[model samples]
Target: MGKALIAGVMRWQNTLDLTMSPGNVVAKPLEHVIAANDANKFIAYNNIPPDIPKIKTKSNSKANKNKC
Candidate 1:
């Protein structure tokens, strides 16, 4: 499975194994990739809450660029 650098942003992942024979470097099927994602979700974001709290980006400071 592809390492979760961030999160699974794309549907496809390069799990192509190069340790085996040169001819065996083919990518796995989409179903396997999807399953890997399912397993990865828990390990990756397990510490995070189900509904991540939104950060308050609004600021009343004069330095705010969007104040206009």
Candidate 2:
């Protein structure tokens, strides 16, 4: 795992136990960086270049009007 993937204290105290979501701290550390993406966000926006025109539909044609 990359340095960014590992953060905070190596030891666990009550303060380090952030977030109520339960998880294991004993996970084996990886030696290499891993690649990941937001699957839902990727599928929704499709990584399309912003300059490309989108097909305007009834529901989305005015989606950007409020930006102005």
Candidate 3:
């Protein structure tokens, strides 16, 4: 397995344990960093840019307007 994949797996396991145990506020930042690095590594290896889906908001103006 690649370094990134290994790192990711380790971080995931750590995060899971932390979540299950509770009260590890001090480790949250490090956990986040690990997760972010894992994501970056995966993205780099896949050679695909991250695609964040856009949220579509519905406008109520048309439906709320008084009909003349």
Candidate 4:
């Protein structure tokens, strides 16, 4: 009975090791490469001119004009 218990414990340990092994970890660099490629494609397809001027306005101008 003791020998059977030891064998069962060893088998369970092996199973745990297999399930938690680092060799089963996913490759992160491959994911980064895929993300960068996707970003490049997205930027290429959605290109907008960079020289456009942005509108800037003061918020209190309307209240000051109303008081005048």
**Could you estimate the TM-score for every candidate?**
0.17, 0.20, 0.19, 0.14
Runs in model 1 deviating more than 4 A are 1-13, 16-50, 58-68
Q: How far off is residue 60 in model 2, in Å?
A: 0.5
**RMSD to the hidden true structure, all candidates:** 11.3, 11.7, 14.8, 18.7
Candidates 3 and 4 compared by TM-score, better number: 3
Best by TM-score: 2
Residues 4-28 of candidate 3 have per-residue lDDT tens digits of 2246355432223544433567446
Superposed by TM-score, candidate 4 places the C-alpha of residue 8 at a distance from the truth, in angstroms, of 30
Model 2 poorest 10 in a row by lDDT:
26-35
Q: lDDT of all the models against the reference?
A: 0.43, 0.37, 0.43, 0.36
Reference-based lDDT, residue 53, model 2: 80
Q: Which ten residues in a row have the lowest lDDT in candidate 1?
A: 25-34
- 2 or 4, greater by lDDT: 2
Cand. 3 Cα-lDDT = 0.43
Could you tell me the lDDT of residue 17 within candidate 4?
A: 30
Candidate 1 local lDDT, 1-68, one digit each (tens): 45323365655555544434334434333334335353544323443445567444434233546536
**lDDT by residue for model 4 over 1-68, one digit each (tens)?**
11222463554321233233345343332344335453442222223333345444573234445555
| Candidate 2 C-alpha lDDT tens digits along 24-65 | 242222111121433323222554544468776675554546
Pairs of residues at least 3 apart in sequence or in different chains that clash in candidate 3:
none
Q: Roughly what TM-score does model 1 have, to 2 decimal places? A: 0.17
Question: What is the C-alpha local distance difference test score of candidate 2?
Answer: 0.37
